[model samples]
Target: MAHTPFKSVGMVGLGKMGGAMAKALVSQGTKVFAFDPNLKETSVEGVTLVSTLETLASEAGIIVIAVKPNLVEPVLAEFQKPAIFVSIAAGISYSQLVAKTPQGSTCVRVMPNLPLVANRGAMGYFCEDQAVAHVERLFYGLGDSFRVTKESLMDAVTGLSGSGPAYVLTFLQAMAEGGLQEGLSYEESLGLAMETIEGTLVYFRQLRRKDQNLHPMEVRNWVTSPGGTTIHGLDALERGGFSTAVRDAIRRATERSKELGKG
Candidate 1:
């Protein structure tokens, strides 16, 4: 039988990510037992704040490790059996956790971005056979879940989806700044940038729904009129090596992720 529902969640770090996760859990009717050494906030109605890691672990049936990559192994050492462990740390692998925690312990490693705080996170998770179902049930509340077949592809997923939000945010910031420089108010510029991105996503989804394998170039062609402003901007971006820069960035991020996984 599959693990139906998790009764409680123990979050070790109550920083930004952990705090967001705790809130998401509570919203899902899971009792969250949260802890942090440097917590500056009080307990919520559904989230019971604990003082120590061990106490939180002892009470949780599902433990979500939201701490940094360096801290994962040490934290796993204290975790006991009969509970599923889901980690959102960047570089830690499932093998490391299974070795550190008790033998036969369920483990899943997930890479989630900042957007998950709003339940819109695009996350990739890989798990050992023992823990796959449990992790799926727990993480479906967060956002989209991709069950990666090989753990090695996690680095690529990290590069694509994990670090993707910051890249999009930076682009949005630049677009907004450019709009402001074009005489639009700051708020107006930001609003325009946000809607443009949102509408583009909707358009892409609609195209997919129509069974179209729409390439980015094809989409650009659809919008670019002959000698139009859009075409001029595209020419400038092409000259600036925008596509190459993005490709190199993804490559570098993937390589760094590989290095991190090794560590």
Candidate 2:
């Protein structure tokens, strides 16, 4: 068996990401003491749902603050004990977290996406130097967890990977619609679109780390020939401002993250 930093953890909120993480953690043989104001996301089999934050804190030495950005403050206030904090609140900064917790506390500011529910997610974090391995251990089996050299870059991670899955889903919807327009049933088109995107990602991942891998554009160009069907589709996407809109979405999210950190 692998070494774990802590076998018991306290989850302060059990919303979407929180609940998924709790399930995943318990699946990895960790005991989770979860507390949610609304008593939601407490139904996962292995999770021991506590009625109060104090009850949760009493049992777990490492705590995960899985609340929203706006709710993080009050939630942090309730954690009267000194413990390792793994906060997944988007837009919250490292300084903000350390400020809210007990003095000399350790906190990791994490930005994990919705895909974590499926256990195939991107988990980006920035933490105190001493907490690196401990933080990684918290998310070890849950996703592709990694740390950033600087805390400021977490905003970019939030903008890109944190919000990226939605963009992919949006593109998938458009692909399904395009097939529907061409007379294919919506269900069939959507199924085909899903498989295509999944297959493409698998292929890209296979070659992405090769010693002499080409740029993504080169791979894209290989699929697109002069005046070919693929090029025509690409041209249509360009004319429709697909690239610009996607870039704007990431930019806007990043800016919002910066604004949130200001608080």
Candidate 3:
């Protein structure tokens, strides 16, 4: 379904993710009206800084609530316009957002990770059918996004992409440390580890684009010759239960997300 193009957008926060998103929207040619009491001025081009949320609501058709989860309710209460509301506050559900706004308002709950600062974030959202296209277009500038059919699945999304960055960073740190143990300087090891992960991701994406159905293990096998160094590393990982540990981490995070939502 075709979505009505937004003429103007409002943003209530100007933190890292919100600022990045505001910049991205301006780059896409959308007129943005923003209100952030903490900021004296937002230096982004095409963003009009409003004095109050009421002024912002009056000027924009859609309002993005980018404040912290605990602050979202109070922010929503300030601007009860019947605009399409897009929220990025973690663990806040659609029902909670709806209850704070006026009748007929549309609420979209989105879970976006830290990578949004670089416009490479992964976002999963749930909203009514009518709002899906609009929400998708709004977030596409920040990177890949998918619609969550069941709101319950958003907890899993939070567990994965939401908290996944820290997990990846920890793994990267371990890899760098291992390299350091082998006589590489800290900076050199860190650079090598980052590049290896980045390159591997690019190659995996290329394979996916070509519609290849090969599993990651298949690709790993192609490089792991008999009695190779890669095999030794693989054996160490298996003995450490690396795969199971990763799964357990995600499972625990998902459960935590569910618990947070309950509050």
Best by lDDT: 3
TM-score of each model, paired residue for residue:
0.91, 0.95, 0.94
Q: How many clashes show up in model 1?
A: 0
lDDT accuracy of residue 55 in candidate 3: 96
Query: Candidates 2 and 3: which is better by lDDT?
Result: 3
Q: Which ten residues in a row have the lowest lDDT in candidate 3?
A: 1-10
Per-model CA lDDT versus the true structure: 0.82, 0.88, 0.89
Model 1 vs. true fold: TM: 0.91
Give candidate 1 regions above 4 Å deviation: 1-5, 43-45
lDDT value, candidate 2, whole model: 0.88
Poorest lDDT segment (10 consecutive residues) of candidate 2? 207-216
Using TM-score as the measure, the top candidate is 2
lDDT of 3: 0.89
- Write the residue-wise lDDT of candidate 3 on 87-191 in tens digits: 987788889999998788989999999898889999999999999888888986688998989999999999999999999999999999999999999999999
What order do candidates take by TM-score, descending? Answer: 2, 3, 1
What TM value does model 3 have? 0.94
